[model samples]
Target: MKRVIRILISYALALVLVIVSMNCSFVNIKADEQVYLSVSKSNSWESEGKYYAQFNLTITNNSSKNLQDWTINISKSGGEISQSWCCFVSDLGNSYELKPESYNKEIKAGENISNVGLIMSFPAETSNINASISPVFETEVKESPNIKEEDSNKEETKSQESVEVTEEINAGDEVETEEIDENLANAALVASRCFLSYADAPVIAIRACYDYMIVLNTEPKEEQETIAEAAVTAAQTASEFATDGDVESINTANNANDDNNAYEVSKDNEPVIEDSNPEAVEDNEPVTSVAGNKNIPTGRLRVSGTKLVDASGNVVQLRGVSSHGLSWFPEYVNESAMASLKADFGINVFRIAMYPREYAGYLTGGDKETLKAKIDEGVRAAANQGLYVIIDWHVLNYNPNEIKDEAISFFNEMSMKYAGYDNVIYEICNEPVGADWASQIKPYAESVIATIRANDPNALVIVGTNTWSQDVDAVVGNEIDDANVCYSLHFYAATHKDNIQNKLRYAINNGVPVFVSECSICDASGNGGIDYASANSWLELLNSLDVSYIAWSLCNKAETSALINSSCSKTSGWSEEDYSDAGKWFMQAIKNQ
Candidate 1:
């Protein structure tokens, strides 16, 4: 076994050297030869006189013991990084120091870590890259103690059985891991990391990998996961956890490979009652609020031939602010804040952004009840203030289809809870990144829509488009065949100029119902300098088309897109001085409407 291990290590080293020599990249291992860092150009392209490339780095733990607290250094010559994932990089003038995130800080013996890389651009003439691992400790390789052949065979048999158990789990078969060796935990962690390399793989495989990482507590650097047994347990049960749903229709939609029609809803399944309090309002009766004024009038809203219309058939253009992630800013989700926005800011819509994968997100270990309570409070507050509320399933780092079952369960419950409320609009997906409209996203949306329609048949539904909801034109001809559905179009005035505006125009011109669910006057990152000129242009276009629009956020965080000044701690009843620059501008825009 030791001889085989040495041979494999030698082969890996030779392969790294070949890649280095061919690509002009570099590799450096610790002096003790326990760890190795190899850098190679995984991809490259040329645009005009500039060269663009992605460098993939692999770290191998060659020692017979676990390696930790290490760093990789890269001496980059004449290239500017455009994007990077899986490692925290520090700029060191001509070089960069990369440190592993918490979940990947330790690599077990003979394990290698991949999916740590970056993309950069440089002048066509310069493309040199040098990489080396730091603090090379000198340690001699130790031989394993010999064991009797009889005992060795028994241990090997146990290890092989454990391996078979994990395979069974991956195949969606339930199995017992009581006799599994604990050491397999580390192997699972390494396995999850390798899974990241399959970017174009099937959604189930990626989701299972994601759940595996989460279960192992090995959130990669990109999002950040942890635990070997828990990781194994996650491996054993992640698919089951992902596919948890009560209704057969939901289970069908959750199955990515199921040929069942995406638009089918099981009417036989009763609406899930989220709350059963004796004092709770009757399920069939709509909650009516007498909180209507000229500035903030509300009623059932419907999509009518490229326009959002009120019950009276008059074209209605909604204008308002969206909350930052509810988990992050629960303090702002109060009735007083809703009243303030309605009375002072002249806004009629409030979007509650519930992230599904961010810190304390709904699907990622967030206190589900707590987040749901906040959503409930926001919905009721908006209704009581005569404001239409958008329940946004904010998907920043994940695709909508990756967690379709969870989404189905959530929207099912929410739609049921707010079934009778006319002011509540279900924004099924806030922003879907790297999702196809015709294939992945459309089907996911149809399934979710079918679920929503089960309870609230006529409630307005907003669906996100591809590429962070900016590709609204993609839905021009391939729109969802459901009534009262609008495609989301998000923008930041500083980043999305006429190109995005043209896309919106194209969608609208092609008779696609469009809703600007989230937007800001700053850059797309929700930061950077405010571009009021571009914001005004956007408002002008939206107003002319009578398109409803909502600002990116209403939080007081010290950022470009925050509506309130960071210094103001007060959650409601803000004076003119309490508004951020973007906030003040948005306030005036709502008043103008």
Candidate 2:
């Protein structure tokens, strides 16, 4: 019985030892399998421009014991993990897996296990990276292997070298840095210089280039301050070569950062200089006592170096053409065609009709592109001909206030472009009538005239009286305050509104410059007019009064007093041969005066 008891005890002891050893083996086991993992990246990166950054990770294991069911985790401070892999282990465990966050490999004692790969993206903007790796083992028992000190040291050195290279690249110290490219830098410099030269203002040029460089460098905070400072210095240097009215130079100089303190120096000295010149202040005095009437056009109309005089002085015949609807008919005013006709005819001025339908297209929810093209083509053609082109804001049925804003924009663009050119004038509103005259037309006309004069002080502006330009009494009553202003009135014998001679007398007597921008022997319905017979009579009266007259139509048609028939053909009414009849008589009248 004693012998049997002893044997049972020994068996029990053996079982306990086996269980304890199994648990101890797993705790002491070190992965013996050799594993290798690496990462790679691409050269191109962002949409705005190109960039390059890649994170590479390599993992290797060398041990005698099998590594089964282990976990490995990797963490990087400034990179995005794009891909990962897992490994499987079998033996001494039912089923185990290794994940990227916890990368684990399973292999036999002498075999090697490695992750497929891991890809990470590091942006160029990132400056640092802190990596952490952890490995958990769950396999057979084995002693931990001693890694070579030299090999560990080599890995640390390589990592430090990689960090240094990344730093250099971020700092733009790399040979491939775009900002530092000699060709690119030179191009930028040349462009900036050209801009400064043209602006004639060093401050403006400097400011523009500074902005450009900021864009070129993508406005990085680190580069902004440095580039801005450099731009200021460059602009100041350029300003030394610019003249007083050299806007480009002034702009460039003003834009320079270094000159910011000196930007308003000239302005500050203006008061002192102005005080010294007493006559200057008097000359600059406002033209009208009305608070906002300072911008009115006030200049004497001169012809042949002599100021135009009325019956009180020498006779001055103004031979003008009523260029009806010329802007609406840009095709007629061709440079090669109309220019020659105008010069040959001795036509000094032309009337422009503003059609509401054409202008409303842009102002009232219509196609802007089409309207702009039409306007640009018409204005440029007339200007190129060197003929005094009138910008007629025609409102046949007045709604002046309704179209005021659009009208102002149109006039401003016109005046600004033609400000210094002597061959342009403005006609505020055409043919306003009835109650619309006082309530809408007058106010609207006043606004437009003010806008144009603000941009072009010397522009000759024509204002029409109410009642379709037939109310001479209303015109003389309202009376424009501007000296350079003139009144426009239309006459058609068929209407019998007033005698042409009587109207002329009233205008001359009142000392108001009268311009017959539109008139026709043929009635509004386009009938009745014995060709030159009636037209010649009207022309005689106009010539006598020295009033400028533009014929009703340059091209003959059913709706007009056709000066030239369709196809530019001389019809029975007025042939091309006869086209010169009215023009010749008008020229003779002017020469006689």
Candidate 3:
């Protein structure tokens, strides 16, 4: 009886030991949980209008458990909520009340889930937004399959089955996901607000519609179609909200889009709207005194037009000293010096020659700030003296095309900054040469001119000919398309320059306005390098031909042709008494004009 009892006890002890060993074999796999979210705007604030904000959410799981049910909540402080949508996910099972659109995914252990879409719209005025999401939950964690050492080979088969199930669920979720373009939403908003009333309603509506069309054309084909449909719907809605003026505007807009035949019909039926009283129209037009007129020539230097006309409608003669170096040294062009030029020398215009690249160099390196300040000071000084300032693009080397993009940016900034000012004239290119005149220079010049016109349509733009601006023939050949364009040429008759007679005759006979934009003479032979006597002869001829001329250099001390010496003093050779020869000559030319 004692032996049997001991056997029973031993069996009980063995059972207890087996249970302990099984518990020790069970593994607890820790999950690596993480969440990621990001925010972005479709367009930056620098753009013209409001833009949309987009948010993205991603979840990652790194455990043996399958995460199922989850919730995400997004919040914002500013801006009204416009609309919201989410992607579809299918891991939570039918028991969970998870919204199909918001369900991210059932992330298996060591698997990652991602979703990108509009969580919500924080309207145009919102400045800040915040978002948060809850951790994923599962109905229950399944226990590992019971297997002995002999069943270890089945582990790979079980893993494959889990993967296939997860993939099938993800595939189902993907079908319901939708994407929306933020740009189209912004466009719809703009269209809705564009039209309000009738006196001016039609014109306003047409402009708004045209703007919308431009935006649509720039978008991708699919997006463009979407935007077009939205725009059309918005336009119809706007018509309903509009007053009687609004209806008229809509009709006008529709008429503008009509065929050419319709346009002709409208034109034919339209009554003449001319004023019977010329006095009424004259009252509306701007009037300027003949003496106060300082109209910057609208066309190129070579074109014959009334842009720089005197009171009699003849070509106006502009005699001046080329103060290109003054731009480099603003301190020299003080009130005293400008006073000297105006009161004593009678200089009418100042050609401020600027080396395109070198002048731009002042904006780089440590001298950037200083250079900008100096340039501004110089511009102001010239303006204060009531002088016409020629912003010359002095290109000794480097094709204009090489820096065309930079030039456009520079010119746009300049044109807009001084659009209404009549004192400034933009010289698009300087001294173009070689084949670049046709290939690089002309195109670059045209581009810069267009840029300026886009901002200030009336700004005077001067374009130079090739070969150091000595090729008047080239200037006549490749004419600019713009009526306001002007051609420029440089002259140094002392270097066996082109005959003044030939140049003047060609310019006058061909109806091209010629300005010897730059000239220097040192001797009567016309080949002794910037000779004063030779320059005087050319000047007299230019005066007789009703031509304009700007002396080459106001700040070179070189004997060849020094108007103002290195010390900013008048050259002794011209006039010792008061440095009045150049000044007297300039005054006479102004009087004649």
Candidate 4:
């Protein structure tokens, strides 16, 4: 077994402190080597003469020995990196140096330390990437060895010998050790924001490598005073290089170990540094805040070739559930709850069903300002959590034409407010029951959609169809020519199965963009026993076609579609014990997915 250890060099006087084995061409785990390095592309895309790729770097320990330290050289032939996360990276002339900080120095064999994601941008001329790792060693620092000045005579002799050995195993890279004696006493910034985000880290861990090793302990009580001070000082020096107002330069790496951070990724557009490393950037700072949200789309979404594609031109599918009318159960419109749905409940998007005509709805007796505020809150929370949010103008029982002025004004307000947010999707009409497609509903859609376009032109818009949004084929016949516009189609598993589904197939094949804005497992009445099997069938169909969907509702209204039971009062953190039968099924489905 073998492993590739990335040993970062600091310029100062010291001796080599490690031993390892090397192989011709590349180092692989076997003999004295115990660690190996490998990388794979998690996502890739290109736009505007630039290519973007997210690569995951994996370091596997395949031997019985405990590996001590390592270093790797990664460079693109004709490109430069925008930034990286999960570790500190220093730009080294032609290549970037990947090194583990104090907290990530140890490797217990067979256990993998993953979640090292790199975001790179390169010119169109660059078409290839190169990566390789150097020497590895088997060792663990059970305790620090004494090297008092009184033993300098012996230490100097050993140090000289160690330095000679380091040069032999270092391959082509130079290895040096600098004794960091500076104090971080006056440094007000976060020392190691990168270290703070380690999995299961509060104090975190750091390992010292090279010829003269200095092991830094995570336990502050151990009181390795000089090493601790050096770790903080070393981190401070690295963070000084953080570029101002550069979102691509800051680190927003969120891993399982950073639960102690207890905050959401920033979605604010104003320039503020989120953090150079894993530390929380002050609110409103332009910082790279990667919150481990793998579901968040990295690029703008649009319809192309009869399917939804992200900015990278890769067909993408989204799956999530919508909230019931925001008139009730407004408690879930905060950051924690929305984050809970994504982190704990496994949802990629949350739809805000803003009813314009219900009892407590916006257009009715409901205070328009209050309703709008709640909608704003929901969108912001979803944004902060790095989840997609759909702002729906729910029009049921009455045509959107009846509330034409109100709908236009509302959409214009929302679109303008969330104009810059890619997570914000606009659903102009929820259900245009019994309206004519090309004459009545189309004109109303034209008015509202035009209003939204006037504010946020690039955002994805979903228009409702006539007769409960089941007429997707109608949209295909007279489709909107806009670039990112999609038609809404809703379904109740127990009610409209094959008929509407068949129409959907025809519409999709004919090139109409469809987004299922609402769905339920029961009849249209929103109550009674669930048709889970039918719902599963619907899900399969949606998945097969790369169609995105929002399951109908996140309320406790005692309905088969309501995810929470009537007896449950908590807005977030609802477990299986708190779910209705339908809720249980949906939760199970999300987990399965």
Candidate 5:
């Protein structure tokens, strides 16, 4: 009888503790504004007696965390959406759920999207919706991976600095360390709430903790890390608990908490959604791109005073790789492969080499239409990945006059197809060797130029110079009279030393704009040894000039120029082990930043 009574008492206490612990998460919810949603009637004229109008929805995400499967549910006088643009809207009786489109799907931190417009019909001027409306959003429920090792190293450095400051405070120095430490701690506390995964916690919390702990000058190193780790853990746990709440509610027959339940990230990184029932995303919801630091925004490019200027009138230099003949190596033109180049290798542009005269090239090949379609697909992929694209007409030994008509047709099709896209660049001729810039190549370029300009007048066009694009000096006096025009400069580091760079300098000093369309740190044969000394010299020169350039051949060929191994087959997400010597060098150069 005594043993039974003791077991019952212990069981009762355990249940009470569990209830209190769970309740603490729910009651201690921190709320701030990291995301905001607003809706307004942009253009609306009633279509029928039932009433109809156009509404513009805007979302602003200010946090660094990447969110997916986001939803925006609104009830405005029980309205039904008929058509939507820039987003997929599913009508749910009186409310609606909105998902992002490809272009605006993954809203990067500090980005605002105001293009989501909808045509909906409802009673004219609903009271609460039209008068005053507020919206709420949910962060990603899935746990992100651990922080990168590099990021941890950075945190460890900051933590050490804080310890030094605390030592000063202990020696009768001002409480400066404490103030600095508290500020950082506050920031980290907020970061913890924003990025729930361990990967992101240090991205926010570590540095902050270092600052705060320095003020607590007396605290040991281990103690500082412990305190920071605890704060991050609390925030992460809160997010997981909230997601559970959302999921639990979804499985129920009636979601009674749907209307009143919403979560937000506060200025101090606090959790808003703490309920165990999550709003589950459907299996078919369009997934957003992973948040990456490689995405670059190259606004409209143009030729301005012997340099390439972006839309904001700032001179821009594009660094990237060109493919080694599209038909021969189409495997590397995939989204995943190109993404690795951008994210890991730091390439801003990808040059598509369209050989018009190979054994099975575009013109005489059986895959005529298929080749064109593949080129089109590559351009679309570039745009989707936020990368600039170059459509190179790889003309080596063939005379431009022989295929003038075909070239005209091809440029017309491509220019019209990729019109208005800031990422598209036209490389009219890859190499003009058999003719002079003024007489032979110049005339051929005029015709093709006229064709492309007819379709895309504002696109950046790169014309090949004579002597296989080494004779840029010839284009000094006889420059194209079109807007956004630049001359191509190709070089082989081991073969064409400062001799070629002399001509490059002469052209730039004069009134000629140049773009290094193709280059490699090897001999011209594409299968020679790499010359690092010469390559470093060239790098120094380009950086001084702020010149835009693309490396030679992003293929798996057994050569010095190829970035990857010949046997390795990967489209994207490549590890460092997958790269060759040349590829490794490029990665280091970019990361040297």
Candidate 6:
């Protein structure tokens, strides 16, 4: 009788605690009130008696709870939408309802989702097209006596089970660490939420958690790896979700998070110009050493009607690889390595990437003279190997105009230094993120081009487009006046799909000179799995169009984008086995071309 009374008392207490927990869960009922929505419209383009307008929608969640499966009501005065991204639209009589796609369905608390836009086509006669957006928050249900008895019973059982598990864990019963540490699988997701919540969360913090997840993935025990794989997938998905299509944030996070620290420096295979005969490479030769040799190729490169042409108006496609930053990978620029590539692969061009914003970069406390010397060496090496070289001003973190004066000074000096060399090309900007084509990038490019033209008038100059050089279509009608300039288009095959390919096609068809300044077989983050199919398709398109393309990059860093294997530290003369997976694919692609 005493045992039964005690059991009943315990059951009563558990039921009371369960009721309290259920009541607490209702705190999120007013979450919809904390969310805000705004819409802005811009005229994207005018074509064929139709005006295309983009309605960019932004949703900001201020609540502590995440918002998912959300709906927004958009009322438009005129025009019909041709296409939309990041959301699905449904017509409901006079208005439209928008729902997020599965990938971006959840908007974490305190985070805002931008770049959710739709293009609407309006007849040229229609001058005023307007749209308004409002979130369709879930209806609030009041607490009533008519509650479902079964639901209450289920909640009670769940709460009771949770309590039992906690008690068991506290009692020190043998429990699988995986079961107890299930939250580890969700660490990335939680961290992503936290990142969205805090305005000052360091990027390295997120990278540390992601790196730990990678370590979990490589665990020797299968049981331990189950959660690790989940964490990795969650990290990738969370990374995608957190950025909400912002290219700058994605690139910054990616650049900071790549597995660069995992690289091994091989003492035996140091980056040196080794040769059977030491006299093959002469020291400190200028570009004029082979200036008059017709066999080594002569004449300045010019842009002629969507094609890079020689002085004789013959179309030429420059296929080559770009170095990883010169400050970090200077040893890869030796003459023997370039000569070996020219002999084996028939590569015609080489790009020297000089980062200006990263650690040890030119603009950030690095030895400017030392970097300039490295660039000079690389240019000389490429010129000696009968290869055209590109001096890349790799701008990533800031808009081109943000550092316009510095760019002008840098380009002025470089162009004057290599003015007489036909083999030297200038990439004014590597990847201009978060800059407008008509205002920011174009103006800055014009300034730099003007400076370069003062010295090398006919030199082939490449300019980056908006959205980290992925939005080539943005440069179609609003092109720079200089005929020698080519707009840059960069892509990572695994992340970019037909939409990006369509941008390239549109740019080419519209006579916007397109040059793929940087591309790879991995994701945009530069450290994910390879997409051979997409890469092959992209190469086929480039080949058909005779568009110049460059692979990124030349280094032994343990990332998917690195052309060389991390284990093999040789800077040049890479055999089949010395290539990473993406490296091998890129090498074969270049060879096939």
Clashes of each: 8, 36, 23, 32, 25, 0
> Which 10 successive residues of model 2 have the least lDDT summed?
16-25
Q: How many residue pairs of model 4 clash at the backbone?
A: 32
Tens-digit lDDT track of model 3 for 131-164: 4444443322121212123432332221132111
Name the lDDT value of residue 490 in candidate 3. 67
Tell me each candidate's TM-score: 0.59, 0.42, 0.44, 0.51, 0.51, 0.55
Comparing 1 and 3 by TM-score, which wins?
A: 1
Candidate 4 all-Cα RMSD: 22.9
Candidate 1 C-alpha lDDT tens digits along 1-593: 23233322432232221112113433434334456666666445565566766666667778665553457766667776655655667899987777654335557678766546666778874544666665222122121122122322232211122111111122332433421222223233233223212121223333334333432232233223223223334334333333333101111111111111111111122243321222233324222222322222546888888999998788899999898876556667766676677766788889998877643467654567767877887787676667789999987634788889999999999999888887889999887766778988999999999999999998999999876688899997898899799999998886676768989999999999899999989865566688889999999999999889998787765577889886665677678898899999999999877
Give me the candidate number with maximum lDDT: 1
Candidate 6 worst ten-residue window by lDDT: 17-26
| Least well predicted 10-residue stretch by lDDT in candidate 3 | 258-267
Model 2 C-alpha lDDT per residue in residues 1-593, reported as the tens digit of each score: 12222322332232211001111012222233333333222111332232223333334434453333234333343444433323212122322222331112333344433323333345555422333223322221111111122222222211122111111123333445433332223323323332111111223333344333422332222243344445444445445433432322423222222311111111111111111211121212311111111111222233221123332345444455544443223233323233344444555455555554221223422234533444444344444444455667765534456567877888888788667655566777666544244555567767887888899876777776654565544455555556666667776543322354466567567666777666666543233433455555766777666666555555433233545542242211222354533344444543454
Instruction: Please list the residue runs of candidate 6 whose C-alpha ends up more than 4 Å from where it truly belongs after superposition.
Output: 1-298
Candidate 6 lDDT over 1-593, as tens digits, reads 12222333433343321000111011222343466555555335565566765555666667665553366655554566665655667887775667664334456668766646666766764433334333322111111112222322233231142111112122254645433232233345333322121111234343334333322332212222243334345445444544443211111121111212111112233243322222232223211222222223646788889998887888899988888876566667666566655654667888999887554467754557767877887776676666789999998734778778888999999999888777889998887756888888998988899999999887889999876687889887888888888989998886566768889999999999899999998866566678898898999999999999998888765577888886664656567788788877877777776
Better of 1 and 6 by lDDT: 1
Candidate lDDT values, in order: 0.64, 0.42, 0.43, 0.59, 0.58, 0.62
Measured with C-alpha atoms, the lDDT of residue 401 in candidate 2 is 60
